[model samples]
Target: MAGTLKVGLIGCGNVVDYGHRPALLALKDVELVALADITPARRLIGKAWFRLRERQLYADYRQLLALPEVEAVVVAVPQKFRPRIVLDAFAAGKHVLSEKPLSNVPAVAAQLVAAARHSGLQLAMTHNYHFLPEYQKLKQLLSQGLIGAVRVLTLHFLGVIDYPGAAEYQADWRHTLAAGGGVLMDMIHAVYLAEWLAGAPAQQVMAFVDALQYAGREPVIEDLALLQIAFPRAYAAIHMGWGAGVGGLDISGSDGHIRLRYKQHQSGGFNQPIELYSVDSDWRRSDHAIPNLDTHEANIARSFTQLWADFRDAIREGRAPIAPAAAGARALEIVLGAYASAVCGRVISLPLAAADPVYQKGIAGIAELEAWAGSKTKAAGLFGLRA
Candidate 1:
């Protein structure tokens, strides 16, 4: 709590390797004091990346939490196992920053919210889209009523997991349905960002999800998703896929509209400017200078720099983080709600009741996938599969 906040990382996975390390290094007030990973190879990889001493390496995160030096923790592990680790960190009296989706299941996510509130510790979620410069500009414009009375928003993302040689899907947990896999997992940022830009929670959703291209290799998880979300006094459509094409957003308001463009750089791609356009009366169109934030790397680490700064400040001030667990929870609701609607061929309402199965257990709780979208999910339980 004093000089650089001593931080421990719980998962030495891809996001940690590429994103968290860079963000932590970029923050003057934060220190990467120690790291814990289950995989020995991953632990060594992190040590080599951060030049961590042997004493700084840990296989069990609990041991890292036991250390008095660590003041904060970043839960970058898979969504399924994160609830336990996050709870443990709070129990250890450390503040926490968790990866997106909160958890694959909502019940577990609820537990985290309860624990963090009772523990009186800040639990920040990595809903970092709001930090991007372009998004910031758009938010500013809307706040000024540049695009008055936002009525609808449509976000589009098209492209396969364009990792060179398909690296993202190759032997990755993201390819597994039970792990909260596919476009929803990969692009839940869009859901959260939509809410941020729209200024309201989705009231209902109807969607279609399928694995259009990866039928042979990874047949269970969905790669293509088209979701329609209904908001009070507004509407939103989000389409993302592991297919191919251009992607962006078109937001229409009573006065005008805003268009945004972005690309997901797969392999070591640097930051790219986000192009935004504004249209006004008399068919007047405004050409805008590019925004500086890079969309290519959220999970890769670039965007989290601001996210970390906010988290650090919030922890110090005894205030709520910029992006809290509630935002993440809403995104999960829209996501799992989409899955439920797609499965049942019915328009699923949002902020689902506690008794709704998907509200409690995520996509695995859906009982009729074969009837509507017909996804080939082989999920066995909350945590395991038949693999």
Candidate 2:
């Protein structure tokens, strides 16, 4: 607790190996003290990769949480399992940095937020995109009035799930309603980025969803979800999908506009470019490509490291967490509202109450819904056999 903050890590999935482990290791102020994983194979991989001693391994996260030296926890568990682990960490008197999308349901997310607040522990959400240098520079420019009163924001985020040939690979727990999968939850990075750049919470939202390309897959969750949000001084639109396409954002303001495009490769690399246009000189344009900076994966690791550094500083100062618990919950609310709007065929407003039909029915005790989704999916020939 004095020189290096002892860190306990939960979950040893691909994200932990690629992102969290490297990030935590890079920070001099932090030490990876303990790790927990349900899978022995994963725990072994983490232990071997990080050179952790055998005594630091645990199959149950509660044991890790009980470590007196652990001042904080980095929760990299799957989205569905996060809420419980986060709450437990707080109850054990440890701060938390949870992976994105918060949890599978808004109700569960709310409980996590409440627990963090009550325990007076910092709760930060990993929204690495917001910490990208280009994004920060852009935000600084906008705050300096370079764009002069924003008016509109638009984004297109689409990707293909390279899930071999198994139905479970594509329509597994993550895609089920109970697990809070589908386009809305899986592709919500755009929603978080938009709200952050727009500098305001979405006041109202309207959405349209459909089972566009993956009709053969089971589970009625939509493959495409188009969302529109009306903010106080700006309006925003997002097109999310699971098809083979990619695009980025275009923000138009009274005086200028900014554009970005992202390309993902099967070879595990990415190309991204950000451009700016100003109306002052007949809409003159200037653009720059984000340097790959040693593989896109490394860039993500660096970003995550920066994110955790900010969280550490916030915890030390007794200030708000880098990405506060409320912000994480609010992001979930926006995604849930979008889904509710699509299902109910109407616009949905913010600050949803516990009595809202969507909250009561759509997200309430999702295990039942997951089971139903699994059955419906299996019956619908999601396993790739035609009935």
Candidate 3:
């Protein structure tokens, strides 16, 4: 807590170029001690970015984990390869900061959370959207009773940019079913934000998930997902897609309503927000100024920086990080549930039953469920559902 925190990084992918690199460079109390990536080019890129010596770079992440100076590590690999590394980190007595969606399978994600709890090591999620200035202000207003009791929260991210993975790896991995689900799974940010804003865990979820953009190609994953989720006392609807479409946030509360519009109708991380305002019961409109009004790129960098700081402080104070592993697990279940709902045409419950195939195998288990004749996901050939 007093001195610097030494950290190692795994998976030197494209996310490091924008998301984590700036944070590691900006946080004075955190040092990037080592980096690991299977791809040599990516490892070299990280070496140059972090100014790490050849000895500090590794092809096997286990070597980086072996370092005694690394008190913590950030796991930035794809969801499929993360479980083992994270488990190994906890076993090695190192705190872990994991990227989103925890794991492709809900059961596996739960196991990671349990492992972290049993090890008494931190397992924080990179739900950095919580630290974004717009979302932070939105949470502030909601907590201050600006919207009274939240009734319905809608997040529109239809214009998500389809950025590819590192060229050294599978660039089109996201378009495959192996990536888990699709755009919604890739951007699980809206899912966690829904729970955080609703102030409870999701109870039930149903969705219409389809590959509208790649429908003609018989895509293995969905490009558009419309989900309706039920919390204890509030509801949230998330509209997500990978193509050009609407993008913004709208909240309808008992006392008032709030709306956020991004510039150029781009998604949250793509462009700066141009408008944010609220309306009261009396139809009085009030505009809220965004705190960090720099370029969207700078805002995103700041969010990651704050997230790393929170991770550091949480470790020092023996407290939970702003985004904990439990939240990520729940979000993963919500997404897997949504995919199940699309395939089976039924609302899926939370903390899915242990006996449920989807709970055990994630999107891979959708084929085990009875499919509806009219299910759009089935029609679109997503999640192994045949028309």
User: Candidate 2, which segments miss by more than 4 Å at Cα?
Assistant: 160-171, 263-270, 274-281, 288-294, 360-387
**Stronger candidate by lDDT (2 vs 3):** 3
- The residue pairs found clashing in candidate 3 are none
Candidate 2 structure quality by residue, lDDT tens digits, 309-336 = 8888888888886578788888888877
Cα lDDT of model 1 by residue, 301-382, tens digit: 6568888989998988888987888888888888888777666678988887788877777766775233443432323111
Candidate 3 displacement at residue 184 in angstroms: 0.5
Q: lDDT scores for all predictions? A: 0.76, 0.72, 0.92
Please tell me which model should have the higher lDDT, number 1 or number 2: 1
Top-scoring candidate (lDDT): 3
How much does candidate 1 score in TM-score? 0.89
Cα lDDT for residue 298, candidate 1: 52
Residue-level lDDT of model 3, residues 1-387, one tens digit each, is 358999999998988888999999999999999999999999988999999899999999999999999999999998889999999999899999999878999999999999999999999999999988899999999999998999999999999988999898789888787789789999999999999999999999999998888767768888899999999999999999997498999999999999999998877878899999999989799999988778988999999999999999999999999999999999999999999988889999998999999999998888999998989888777777767
Q: Which stretches of candidate 1 lie over 4 Å from their true place?
A: 160-170, 263-274, 293-302, 368-387
Residue pairs with backbone overlap in model 2: none
**Per-candidate count of clashing residue pairs (backbone under 3 Å):** 4, 0, 0
Task: Name the runs in model 3 displaced over 4 angstroms.
Answer: none
Instruction: Give the RMSD in angstroms, all C-alphas superposed, for model 2.
Output: 5.0
Error of 3 at 55 (Å): 0.5
